[model samples]
Target: MRRYLRLYKLFVLQYLKTLMQSKLDLAIGIAGFVISQASGLVFILLVFTQIPEINGYGIDQMVFIYGFSLLPKGLDHLLTDCIWWIPGTFVTHGGLDKFLIRPLNVFFQIACEKFQADALGELAVGAALVSLSIARGAAELSVLDVMLFIVAVLAGTVIYTSVKLIAATFSFWYKNSFHIINTIYHLNDFAKYPISIYPKFIRIALTAIVPFAAASFYPASYFLDRSSLAGSIGIAAAAAAVSGSAAYGFFLLGLKSYDSSGN
Candidate 1:
C-alpha cells in the first residue's frame, strides 16, 4: 500500500507537469464545465417558474439534491473516470498491456494516470448550491446530520466508482464497450430529481439495479428530513459495500480472461 501510494504520487506529479505545458487548455476546460453546470441550474430555475413544485420538492430542495449529486459524481470523475477509456482506446488498441507488465495494480495505475481537474468546477458549484439551500432555509442540519452527510458523500462516491468499474470491466469480453458504459453512466442524470416522481419500475431500477438513488437522492432525502437517518445511511452504506465488492470481483474475473495482444 505504501509503494502504491508513492507511485500514485509520482504519477500525479507527472500529470501536473504535463498540465503546466497547456495552462490555457486547462483553463478553458474548467470554464466550459462551469458554464455547463450553470446552464443546468438555469434550466431548473425555468422549470420552477412553470410549476410550484414537483413531487412535493420545491426548487430549493431540488437544487440541493442536484448539487449533492454532483459532489460524489465529480469526485468519481476526478479520481477514476479514466476507467471509461479502458473499453474503447485501451483495450481495443492493446494499451492495457503496459499495465500488466508493471508492478502496481492495473486499476490503481489507470486511476492515477490523470486527474480531471475540470471536475473542480462541478465541486465548487455543488458546494455553492448546497450552501444557498441552507441559507434559504430549505433544510437545517444538526451536527449529526453534518457528519452523516460526509459519510454519505464518501459512500456515494464509492458506489459511483464501483458502477463505472463494473461497466468498464465488460471490455474484457467485448473489447469495445464504450456505449454500454456511457448508457449506464447517463442514468446518474435522473438522480438530480426526486426518485418518487418516477414510476415504480424506474425507481426500482435506479435504486436497486444501478443504485444511483443511493448515491444522491436518498442521501439528500435524509439531509432534508424526508427520510429516516438510519434507513438512508444504512442503505447507502450497504449499496456501496455490495456494489464495490461485486465490481472488484468482476474485475478480477475479467483480468484473468484478458488476452494481451502480444499473445
Candidate 2:
C-alpha cells in the first residue's frame, strides 16, 4: 500500500507537470466547469424566485445540496476522468494495453493516467457555496457532526468513482460504452437537487438503482436536518460500499473479456 501511494504521487506529479505546460487549455477547462456550475446555480435561483421552496427546501438549502453534491462529483471527476477513455478510444486503439501489462493494479494505472485539474473549479465553487450555506444556516454543527460530514463526503466520492468504474468497465464488452456511461452518469444531476421533485420512479432509480442520491441529497440533508445525521451518513457509507463492491466486481468480470486492440 505504501509503495502504491508513492507511485501514485510520482505519477500525479508527472501529470501535473504536463498539465501546467498547457496553461491556456487548463484555464479553458476550468472556466468550462465553472460556467456549467454557474448555469445550474442560476436555474436554481430562478426557480426559487418563482417558488419559496421545493418540498421544504429553501434557496440556501438548495445551494447547500448543490454544493455538497459537487464535492464528491468533483473529486471523482478529477481522479477518474481517464476512465472515460476506455469506452472512447482506449480499448479500440490499444491504449489500455499498457495498463493491462503494467505490474500495478489496472484500476490504479487507469486512474493515475490522467488528472482533471478542471475539477478544481467545481471544488472551489462547491466549498464556497457550502460555506455560504453554513453561514446562512447549519449554525448548530458540533465537532462530531463535522467529522461525520467528512465521512459522508468521502463515501460519496467512492460512490461517484464506483459508478464511473462500472460504466467504463462495460467497454470490455461493448468496445464503446461512452454513451451508456454518459447517460447513467448524468443521472447524478438529478441528485444535486432535493430528489423529491421527481416522480416516484425516478426517485427509486436514483435511490436504489444508480443510487446517486446517496452521494448528494441523502448526505447533504444530514447537515440541513439533524434528525437522522448518523443514519444519513450510514446510508451514504453503505451505498458507497455496496456500489463500490458491485462496480469492482463488474470491472473484474469485464477484464476477463478484454482482448487488447481486438475491439
Candidate 3:
C-alpha cells in the first residue's frame, strides 16, 4: 500500500514538472476557464429572468448545482484528463506500449499525463458560486449537510473517472471510442440542474444506472433539506461501487486485448 502511494506521488510530481514546462498551454487553459465561467453567469441570469422558479428550485439552488458540478469536473480535468483521450491515442498510435513497458501501474501513469491548468479556474469559480448561493439565500448549513456535501463531491469525482474509463476501454475494439466519452460528458451536463425536473424514467436511469444524480443532485437536495442524508449517502455509495467496478473491469478486459501497432 505504501509502495503504491509512493508511485502515485512520483507520477503526479512528474506531471507537475511537465505542466510547469508548458506555461503557455496552462495560461490558455486558465483563460478558457474564465470565459466559460463568464458564460455560465450569463446563462444563469437568462434562466432566472424567464422562470421565477423552475420546478421549486430557485436560482440559488441552481447556483449550488452548477457550482458543485464544475468543481469535481475541474478536478477531474486536472488529475485524470489524460484518461479522456487514451482510447484514440493509444489505439491509433500504439501508445499503450509505453504503459505496458512501464514499471508502475498503467492507470496511474495515464492519469498523470492529464494535468490541465483550467482546473484552477474551475475550482475558484465553483467555490465562489457555492458560497454566493448559500450566503445569498437564508439557507443555513448544519455540520451534517457540510459532511454530505463533501461525500457528494467525492462521489462526483469517482463517477467522472468511471465514465472516462469505460469510454477509453472501448478502444479495445473501436478505435474511435472518444465519441463514447463525448456522449457521456454531454449527458452529464444535466447534472447541473435538479434531476427532479426530468421525466421519471430519466431520473431513475440517472439515479440508478449512470448516476449523474448521485454526483450533484443528491447532495444539493440534502443542502436544500429536500432529501434524507442517509438515503443520499447510501445511493452515492452504491453508485460509486458499481460504476467504479464496472469501469475497472472493462479496463482489465481491454488490457487483455491490447495489441501494439509499434508506432
Candidate 4:
C-alpha cells in the first residue's frame, strides 16, 4: 500500500511538472476558475434579484452549493486529466497502451496526466464564498452537521470520478463516443440548484439513474440543514459503491478489447 501511494505521488509530481511547463495549460486552468466564479456571481445576482429567496433556499445555501459543486468539479478536471480524451486519442490510437506498460493503475495514471492546477483559483473562490456565507448566515452549526457535510462531499467526489470512468470506458467499443460525456456535462447544470426543487422524476433520475445529485446537491443540502441524514448519506453511499463497481467492470471488460500498438 505504501509503495503504491509513493508511486502515485511520483506520478502526480511528474504530471504537475508537465503542466507547469506549458503556458497554455496555466492559462486554461485560470480561465476555468474565472469562468466558474463569474457564473456563480451571475447566478447569485440573478436569483437574488428575481425573488429574495429561491424556494426557501437562502443565498447562503445557494452560495454553499456553488462552492461545493466547484470543488469536485474542479478536482475532477484537475486530477483526471485524460477524461477529455476518451473518444479521441484513447480510442483511435490506443493511447491507453502507454499506461498499461506502467506499474501504476491505468486509471490512476490517466488521472495524474490530467491535473488541473488552475483550479487553485476555484478553490480559493469557494473557500471565500463559504466563509462569507457562514459570516452572513446562521452560526452555531452542530458538529454532527459538519461531519455529515464532509461525508456527503467526499462521497460526491467518488460518484463523479466513477461516472467519468464509466463514460471513458465506453470508448473501448465505440470510437469517438464522447458525445455521451458531453451530455453528462450538460446534466451537471442541474446540480447547481437544490435537487429537491426539481420534479420528482428528475430528482429520482439524478439519484438513481445518473446520480449527479451525489456530487453536490445532497452534500450542500446536508450542510444547509435541508437533507435528512438517512436519505442524503444513503444516496451518496450507494452511488459511490455502485458507480465504482460499474467503472471497474467496464474497465475489465474494455481491457479485453485493447490491442497493444505493436500488435
The alpha-carbon lDDT assigned to residue 238 of candidate 2 equals 92
Q: Ten consecutive residues with minimal summed lDDT in candidate 4? A: 138-147
Kindly list the per-residue Cα lDDT of model 2 for residues 56-110, writing each as its tens digit. Answer: 8889989998999999999999898988888766776878787777788988888
In model 2, which runs have C-alpha deviations exceeding 4 angstroms?
A: none
Q: What are the per-residue Cα lDDT tens digits for candidate 4 across 5-55?
A: 887688778867887789787888787777768786787878698776777
lDDT per residue as tens, model 1, 1-263: 89887877888788888888999988988788778888999999999999998888899998999899999998898899799888876677777888889887888988986788888888888889999998998899889888988999999999999999999999999987999999999999899888898999999998899999999999899888658866688789899999999999999898898887763
Please, what is the TM-score per model? 0.95, 0.95, 0.92, 0.89
* Candidate 1 global lDDT: 0.88
Question: Over all chains combined, what TM-score does candidate 3 have?
Answer: 0.92
Error of 4 at 10 (Å): 1.5
Backbone collisions counted per model? 0, 0, 0, 3
